[model samples]
Target: MTASRISNTTGWLSFAGVVAFVVGVFNVMDGLVALFRNDYYQVTSQDILVFNFTAWGWIWLILGLAQIAIGAGLLAEQSWARTAGVAMAVLVAIGQLAFLRAFPVWSVLVIAMCVLLVYALTAHPRTRAYPEA
Candidate 1:
């Protein structure tokens, strides 16, 4: 890869790391709100897709923490982080969809970020060059 392309790829990866971290932080805040102030959300527990706010609160809180860890790994350029980030981003996007009714705008925004994160993680060129015959 050309030097400029390599640098651009690195930059995108770094941006993805930052995005993951920010998303995680948002999720943590959302979880806390759900846990402490259930009334903050528009929908009631019965209205949510699955479990009540309390259950979702714990779920988000745990997932957020995992995302934060993955973000750190990505920033450090760990190979596992790229794979984990893709998986986590997908999960987060799905979870956001499940959460759409509670907070429509926020869910959509997070889903968009997750999509960007996935693209950033996967769009880079392969580092290993195959032997040409």
Candidate 2:
């Protein structure tokens, strides 16, 4: 007999994906503002990090797209979305950590969300909800 399916909310992975989706939406808005305004500049030194505004624009756009795709896929209980979502979230986290100066609050938030996303994706219930292809 098929094992009974549990609720998607039974674990952190699902929650993480949800968080990623929300954060992604926020990033999209932030990115669009930065891209359109042309007021994106900050102090820089050998120790501080900064992203090229133009390149960052594209990065934000691509990452946002991926985040949405992964979130939607997970919500739909798609297998690939689980892994992709986790991967993208991790990247976002690392990128944030590396560039914390440019976006202190946002970077920290993304990093925190990344950790939670990893936990959620690795959680047992979430794994079961999205079986491998």
Candidate 3:
């Protein structure tokens, strides 16, 4: 790969890492809140609509770990990391759909970030430079 391509790829990867880290931090906070108070996300009065606190806690924790792993991989420019990062980002996007009430704004932000990250990761500049290496 040419130096320019590598440079651009690194740029995108680094940006992805930073963004992921931010999202991860938010998720961690959400998890902690869930752990402390099950009623933290009481946006609905319907008994069936309410999510269990422990379940949400686990979800947030798992997603937080995934984000951190993807962020680290992107920062390091690992080939497998890049692939897994894409998968993780997509999973995060899909997961957010059901978690709209818990983190409405953050869910929207994460979806937008996932869209941007996918684009940046697959862009010609980064693709040409990195070549999956």
- Whose lDDT is greatest here? 1
- Model 3, global lDDT: 0.72
Candidate 3: the clashing residue pairs are none
Estimate, for each residue in 15-131, the C-alpha lDDT of model 2 and write its tens digit.
766877886886676567557764553633333355665556667767877787787777777788888887888888776676677668777877887788778887775246667
Q: lDDT of each model, Cα atoms only?
A: 0.89, 0.71, 0.72
Alpha carbon RMSD to native, model 3: 5.8
lDDT of 3 by residue, 51-122 (tens): 666777788888887778777877777677677767877887787776776658877987898788776666
lDDT winner, 1 or 3: 1
50-72, model 1: which lDDT tens digit per residue? 88899888988998999999899
Q: What is the TM-score of each candidate against the true structure?
A: 0.86, 0.75, 0.75
> Which prediction has the highest TM-score against the true structure?
1
Evaluate residue 122 in candidate 3 and report its C-alpha lDDT on the 0 to 100 scale: 65
Instruction: Count steric clashes of candidate 2.
Output: 3
RMSD of 1: 5.1
Q: If ranked by lDDT, best first, what sequence of candidates would result?
A: 1, 3, 2
lDDT of 3 at 98: 68
